[model samples]
Target: MDAISLCEQYAAEHGMQQKNGNAPWRLFFRKEIFSPWHDAREDPIGTDLIYQQVLHGIKSGEYKCDKEEELASLIAQLYYVEEGPLEVNHLENQIYKYLPIFELKKNKLANEYWTGSIMYQYRRQFGVNPPDVHHVKESVVSFAKCRWPLLFSRLGKPSRNTCTIQTVSGDEYYIKSFNSQKIEYLILAFLNGLKQRSRFVIARKNQCGDDSNDLLDFEVGDLLELINGVCGKELLTETLVRGENTKTCLQGFIQSENVYVLPALIKPNANVMIYADNRNDFNRSQEATAYPQWRFGRDVLDMPLLKKLEGRKEQCNDAMTMFMFIMKYMGDHPSRRNRLSTDITDVIFKPAIAHEILRDELYCQLLRQITMNPSVTSEEKGWELIWLATGLLAPSPYLLKEVVQFLNSHQHPIAFDCLNRLKKLNKGCSRKFPPHFVEIEAIQNRTMQILHRVYFPDETNEAIEVESSTKARDLVCQIAKRLRLRNKDGFSLFVKVREKVLAIPETEYFFDFIRNLSDWAQNINVENSMLQINYQVFFMRKLWIDVKPGDDTNADLIFHYYQYLPALKPISRRTFGEEAENGNLPSHIKNLHMIRKPLTKYFQCEIAK
Candidate 1:
């Protein structure tokens, strides 16, 4: 018959209906048959023709099998045929001559989908009792032994057809087969689980082992212990059984094949069953517990900078380059000035790495820029720079000094903010300041006073120089001696400078006196007397005070002259007395006092000569 007629006959016998001419169904049918024909016109045989040829070839003895009955059964199974099996002993004998046993086994396993379909059909047709569960389990175990000898041996024996495998390091797995047909499925599932959930192991050889106790001999049956993670292969594995009791754990990779599922002789424990679920969590907990205990125990100063920078070369270089770029960009872009500020306060100036960055001159320059940029400078950034500079005080004194000087002149709030920072930096630093630093401190004190006036106007208006009561007392004593006050007891020294009267207590130190004096000096209505006291008591201590007789007033007129001036050239007394009486002396020096005799003895002697 023609191929089309043959297909019609087969369909009639099977009571099969043809599918509609849908593209999907046609495509699916062509794909299922593995047809080479791409289109209806390419090869007229098409999908239906191919199916007909295969069935006809089988029936006509063109195809052969080892067992005619089995071949017929398989063919009928594939075609959904309902008929007695074909008999062909001669074909069966011929087939066996060419196919080996191993090939047969491989082919059977390879056609798993067909085998599954046949089994389903058999169950539907014969209503077979579930193959003896015990027999199926035995078959699976036997297959496991052949396929995975090492893994099977580790499983001592099966309990209720279930196996529990425990590695020497305490990892556990359970394998069970309750149904016959699912044995291969269960084994496959277990293998997949093993691959997904396996942990790494490292092994090292035992040095004391004799020639007889070779490394290979330290196999599954040997005892082993777990240790810290190590790098390398062939090291002892945590799960390896050791031949002898020793303190060391083997370090190495445990071959998955070497792992076995021993038959569970008893029911599995709850903990063993829950192992898979909690293994990762338990591992994380172990790492968390162990990490803090592992200390490098090396001093920071002892660590070589080059060695520390070895693996971090790229990261450190990138960070430094990026920081420089940001600074350069900030300088050009005034509107985005705060970008540099944010970087210092939020990133570079962190306590952990701030010192490291400060050690670099380039980074110090960036810090200086951030501190001085009025548009972008903030109290926080200023403090951060101060902190970094303070740390650099010992290693880079010049850089620290530059940073302080820059901050001292900065109009930003940081100008004031760095005062406390420097104080703290200086504390406990034991290092002596360079001569220039004393001047720097004076400048800082003056800057702090200005900042105090601008930002903290309401803050207790006190003098920056007045730090202690002793300094305040010293200042008062100087004023007393200058005024020749013999009755110094119970007499308060009232300083009239501008509109403010600073009552200097006798017990007050020089610091308090200067502080109060500074406040008094800042008054808008300051008098000439106050300006004179400010210059002489706080400043012109070494200068000569020239006392000239006044033309109109009985009081002598005092004028501050250079200490280096010769007494012979002493100011013409006649000229200064008339000027003092007319109140023509500069307002700044108008309130000068008569020279104390003993202090001005040199000038007096010069005048006498």
Candidate 2:
């Protein structure tokens, strides 16, 4: 409502009080002004789109924001809020993400100034919804994927012997030089105070004709080949490098005055990288989305969800399946349309599942359901299905328009109600989808979530769907199915707790590994979240005594050769006699500290103390 109407409405409701016997002010007219803050309201997605459009317009000269006054006015109109308009101190980089990427790349100083300007102008007008670590990780992954498509082409696979990862950003190119670190890993490590580096062959020497067919970067391709040859099927550790005297282990590789590929004379730092002091290193890092941290209010979104969320007789997962129960036409009500507007947090998607819904194009599946199931159904029922998919949770801004347009084209009743309700925030101010989920107390078949876990035998890890009731035997079966192993027998699901490899009982619940891990974390002075796992649920040949590891299957052969062979130690007269056979092995054979003697020697030496 305009201010005059608002004032008049107030005056009519509560009679206006006279001050100093003055005349009634009827001449005062209200002037309406648009506020970006008011429009920003609770919708970050809408605000993000608006800012993106405005920046794009400015870049295209559609918005004449060249002059200081015009730009100032535009900034004020577009971003001014009570926090920014008249404030001295403030935060930055929240709104600059909306700036044109190309324009933002003009200069470092300009980027900083503009980022600050936009920050001062806007400053989260609606709320303080900041991004979390998970959001940051997602952003990093997206940026990396968008930045270098081919570099990640061989992700979760071998780099092999000949390939140099290629990338292009204008004229400056990037090529993965070494397997010392993945690009994303290094960025995350450094950001988290674990400094690590990765070598990338930026450019090639001697111009080539066919760019696609040829190696555009340095001889990092050859280095990858060398590393692969020496490592073989095993993890390349310092022991491997030292043990194999014939292998030319890589210490460092770089190209400057002359290309230097040095052999390992001195041990290299675990997370160190060969630094090439390029002038554009800073810009290149920024381009990779390495430095700047991005934030969002919430990861999951909620808009128009359940028709009868609040109307549920019981607030449990079983209650959630009322729609299915009503499939035989048990409950019928015309008030479903009105009830759909009321949102309650009783219903939610687990975060991983929510990401899957978007990532795996589950939304498309929902649409496909509508088309496939053309059985005689009412418009209200059909709309219910449509509302569950599109309006169930607020989609990303990129998706919202398409969903709206499609529904409008089809003349679906849901289009206007859904769209209008969101922008207006009619029913509730909190339209955000709840991120965490309700852990089912009853664990009903309808509500139970299939917990997926990764089990590793060798270099490759296999995914297995688990549940609270899923036993170790069930997990083994799933692994066998996934790995296509005919001989699943005699193999144990070994939960490696730090230094210990414990075989999980066949009857024990698969989810109990989490409890075991928690216990292990508590045993040490480490936080559960911060504990770096030594190994995961390891699948290997563990139970069969007198059984040859290679005799059972190809997987057993891998476990035998790589895992067992190196760990196998022998006893001899010189190394160890029957007297000392029962004693623990020395920490190192060359150790001269405390003597690990026979049981008799311990009693003899203790009297001297």
Candidate 3:
């Protein structure tokens, strides 16, 4: 029989009904039984196992009890259906909410597994939602994919066994399904445990020594003792203090019944050590370490505290100590020495400390420190040294000599840049360059030559001579004559520029024609410049009529024609007789007139004959 018929038979025997007075098995059969069964058929073992479990439960009289018992029996039958043998130890109490088994031994085994196995910790960490269980399973699968590729590869295959025996290097390691399942449970537990440990440590570190409310408690910026993980003890300045009521710690606060103290000190733990007391000093040290060649100028080093602690030896010791440390660091490298020289001009060589630190001995020592470094200098390092030398408070003769010597020895782009700047400074200000910088001047000259060559080509030097006196009327006449000869029929001539055509007006004067041509050329190129012209001819049909002998004597019988001719058109003529009177007609048309004269002579000769 079909799944629905079998479900209805079972429901009738078990007295099941729906709220609408229909059979409950009608809906349940479609959704729960038939759908699951159809989907499970895709796997070869699923359908057979489910059918065998359902039949076994019915034959064993497990579903012969009340409604709850029947439901539980059915669920348990479905839950235990799988490819491998059901391990009672692996099924914990979490699964029993759906598969309500009444067997005492199975229930007790599930309780033991829940309390003792890592599944209990997993549930405590992430809750017992179905999605949480899926998350744990996914995490396990991902871990296995990364750590053990061979084992994970067998998981989804239908024919693969859950348990396997393998020999590796003359040894046998037992691989079982239970081990993989157990590991899936333990990963979440370990992560949750580590999270709790970190919270506890942070809590203990923030507790104050005094319990009295009147005492001035420690705030951010208070100096305190920090226990370093590698080093023993170090002093640290607090940068931030987070309260217990803050959102990040709110859960812990509520869980502890709000007994956790307020205003927890948030300091960098054992990983970082802060040696300086003030922010400026700390920042300076950090910057010096990160970019060792960066120079902080007088504007930066002119702190208010420097003036207050000028003569006080004890109070200024920290500043002096940091300076000495920076100096020592700078001395260790050539680039650092360059930066140090610039920095000292701002901090130590100021007017206040001029006598103390910027003496003749110190000046010589600094010059030696800058020039004595044997490291091969690159272009960038050469520029840095030049910057160091240029920023000195009073340009000493020895210092300038040493800078010029360095520039001479290191001839590069950077040296050239420095030389150009120095030359400009000498012209604009009191600074002067030594006589040994002839190579720098030569480099500048050569650079100018290259730039001139690159920007100016030979063809651009020759001027294009355009005749400015060419009249526009002459050009228009030339264009019209050319168009008339090319197109012998009645046609109009136009000058085509881009999409538009310029038609020659019949009464246009010479100046107007010149202006229009100039406007056209200006639109094409620039004003009053010569423009290339393109001409167009539009042809029209002509109907010529001969004049009779009694026509007016002033008429010359030459008629211009149009494309659209009227049915009865009047014949009128404009004068071409002026060309005949002046004998200006071309030789070919004049020869035709000469032939007419000869024909009249022939007629006279015939009459005589």
Q: How do the predictions measure up, each by TM-score? A: 0.16, 0.22, 0.16
- The collision pairs in model 3 are none
Q: Which segments of candidate 3 are over 4 A away from where they belong?
A: 1-136, 139-238, 243-609
Inter-residue clash pairs, candidate 2: 131-295, 131-296, 301-433, 302-433
- Top-scoring candidate (TM-score): 2
Better of 2 and 3 by TM-score: 2
lDDT score of model 1? 0.36
Mark the 10 consecutive residues where model 2 has the least summed lDDT: 236-245
56, model 3: CA deviation in Å? 33
How would the candidate models be sorted by lDDT, starting from the highest?
2, 1, 3
Q: Rate the local accuracy (lDDT) of all candidates.
A: 0.36, 0.38, 0.33
Residue-wise C-alpha lDDT for candidate 2, range 337-450, written one tens digit per residue: 222111111222222123432311333323323331213233244344334333224444565565556565443445555455344332322222321111122121233334
* 1 versus 3: better lDDT goes to: 1
Tens-place lDDT per residue, model 1, 1-609, is 365566666666776645752112122231121211123334433424444433444455444455533453444333333222322443333333322334346664534433443444444533544343333323322332243334222222333565455453477776664542244345444543432332222112223344443332233223233224321111212223322221244333332123322223223345543553344222212443365222111111222222334455554564554344334333322333423223332333232233343344333434534431222223233344443344323334555566566556444454555545455545433212111221224333444221111001112222323221123344445443544533223323344444554454545433334444554454544553223233222221232234332321211112223332334344545547677678876642554334333324555455556
Best by lDDT: 2
Taking the tens digit of each residue's C-alpha lDDT, what string does model 3 give over 34-127? 2101233254444444344333443354323345333333333333332122344555533544332444246557545433433333334434
Clashes of each: 42, 4, 0
Candidate 3, backbone clash total: 0
